[model samples]
Target: MEEQPLISYQHVNVSLQGQEILSDVNLELRKGEFVYLIGKVGSGKSTLLKTIYGEVEIDAGEAWVLGNAMRTLKRKDFPTLRRKLGIVFQDFQLLTDRTVHENLKFVLKATGWKNRTEIERRIEEVLQQVGMENKGYKMPNELSGGEQQRIVIARAILNKPEIILADEPTGNLDVETGRRIVELLQDICRQGSAILMTTHNLNLLSEYSGKVYKCEHHRLTETTNS
Candidate 1:
């Protein structure tokens, strides 16, 4: 039998402040897959991601993430759910006041990691994974755009999440840098984590060639290119 998808959204509807943003949405993400969500700004791309991570509540329909029914997901259980998923933001939301090592350490601690040896080992591992192993001592403000984003990706993988939700991760970088970032994400996907990324960059879609979905008309739909 085939395994169930890591994320499954069936006829899902999401709203904000009594205004519906996405309606009748159906989507799925399986392990070792890289999927892209593309649309113009305000077309609900980010909101769709928000629903998966529990930032936005499901206004209607059914949604399941990492085997938990979204509507039934309780407030107290959010931390558990979030721990299984990694989130990357466009702004590379690292603490400006801390070094890369400290930033990663903070996440590990916040997520319940207590062993200093284990935490240090994991931090080194993720930093090496993102090719920033030697720069752990650098502050966020000291790194270039691409470098900062790499650290952000490193931070995302600290817990070895089942799925990663990246919201325009490359939005602040140049084209070449963005391509590299996407490539890194693809590499991570190959290592068995599912990725659901939102972006406006259509060029990356063709270059990377993964499953593509467009969020428009307040709906989400899969697409193919010849």
Candidate 2:
């Protein structure tokens, strides 16, 4: 049997502040897949990512993510829909005031993970997955750019989300470090969750194995050979 897409956007249109960002954007991401959105700044890559998690409302066409209709989601339903998504931001948004452990713990608590033991275990698991198993004690300031991004990835997976929406996850690091971050994300994709990452770095497209879509002229089109 064929698997259903975790995210599907059919001719989806999105606008911000009365400006069109993405128009007629048809996209799909499935389980255990890594898809990349490549575009220059203001090309709707980030906006498309936002549409997946409900930050930007879909203006027209059919849009669904993790089984929630993007166009019809209620305000109260946003949190529940978001819980099924893991988001990695361009700026490593770790709380500087907290230890790495506390940062992960905060997300769990916010998402309603009440069991203390399970929270700790899940934290360790995701940290290990991102190669930061031993940095749980360090504060965000103590780690390098790459290490901090790793922690962000760790935090994103705390809920075992079915989809990960990453907005320029490597935009801050060096080329080498950025490659490493993408590699970590790919590993996570292999393990199960589908990842949709937005980036302007076209170099990554050649090295990564995944679907590639480019946003240009208010439209999103698949540009990858795969």
Candidate 3:
């Protein structure tokens, strides 16, 4: 039997303020798949991901995320849908005042993970997954750019999200660090989480082959080669 796509958007159109930013956008991401989202500035890369995560409203088509219809979502319905999604950012949005453990704990609590023991275990598991097990107690300022980004990734996975929607996740890191971070996200996909990352790092994309989706001139295009 054919399996359902992890994320599906059909004939989707998104508008901001009063301008149509994206039109006729169609996409399908399956379980464990890794896809790259690329385009120049204002080409709708962020808008596309925002639509998937309910950050933006689509005025004209169907968008389904883990089977929930995005076009009809309510404000209160965000948490239910967001629980299945993990979003990573390039700036490594860590709380400068909190320790890694505390940062993870905060997210766990917000996501309804209340058991102290389970929270600790899940935190450890995700940190280990990101190769930052030894840095859990360190404050955000104590870590390097790559380590901080790893912690951001760990925070995203605390709820065991089915897919990660990353926005320019490696944009601020060095080339080598960017490659490492990308590899780490790819590894996450192997464990069953689909990844949709938006990046302008074409060099990394050239080396990291997978499905490619580009936002350009208000359109989404799929690349079959490279």
Candidate 4:
């Protein structure tokens, strides 16, 4: 039996301002997979991730994420599709003025999770998942760089997304701390959500074993240890 893909892109070509960014891109991510995306700056790593989550429009070809077709998705449909995806940026992107709890609450409300009890429960659940249940009341600025990132991860999982698209998630952390953060993301993948992370950290790729997809020369190539 063929396994279902959580993410699929077929013959995808992405362009910005009339210049092609990604070309002939075809990829698939199944549930519970931890895939590495490696490329130098100006490469299509970010562009590919954005295309998966519908942030970048494909100039040609197709992208399907958890059954939501990208080419045909309407603006109004983005919120619902986005709910199934958790995105962690290189920058923590936390709301500085709001407490960690409020930061999550804002997304919940925006996504139509209205029941107060359910929202609170889900918030606690994700916080606990990221090992920061006690820091919910603290301001984003008060937390360490890594802790803020953890909260960002927590918020990403609030909706139980089928896939997590993380772009340069550990870019701002120290080497040791970055490994810890990568391990946390690995743990999340073990729990059944596919994770596609873009990183320049060759050490992470070398130290932590997983399938890798390299975005380079305007194409994506899957690697295997022969």
Q: Best TM-score goes to which candidate?
A: 1
Cα-lDDT of candidate 1: 0.93
The best-first sequence of candidates by lDDT reads 1, 3, 4, 2
Worst lDDT window (10 residues) for model 3?
A: 217-226
Candidate 2 residues 1-226, lDDT tens each? 9977898899888889999887898999989888888878988888788777777888899998878888988989999988888999989889999999999999999999899899999998988888899999999999999999999999899899998989999999999999999998898888898888988888888888888888889988888633
Q: Against the hidden reference, what TM-scores do the models get? A: 0.98, 0.96, 0.97, 0.95
The prediction achieving the highest lDDT against the true structure is 1
- The window of 10 residues in a row where model 4 has the poorest summed lDDT is 217-226
lDDT of 4 by residue, 42-65 (tens): 899998898887788988887888
- Between candidates 1 and 2, the lDDT winner: 1
Stretches of model 3 off by over 4 angstroms after superposition: none
CA lDDT of 173 in candidate 1? 96
Q: Comparing 3 and 4 by TM-score, which wins?
A: 3
Q: Give per-candidate clash totals.
A: 0, 0, 0, 0
Considering lDDT, which of the candidate structures 1 and 3 is the better prediction for this target?
A: 1
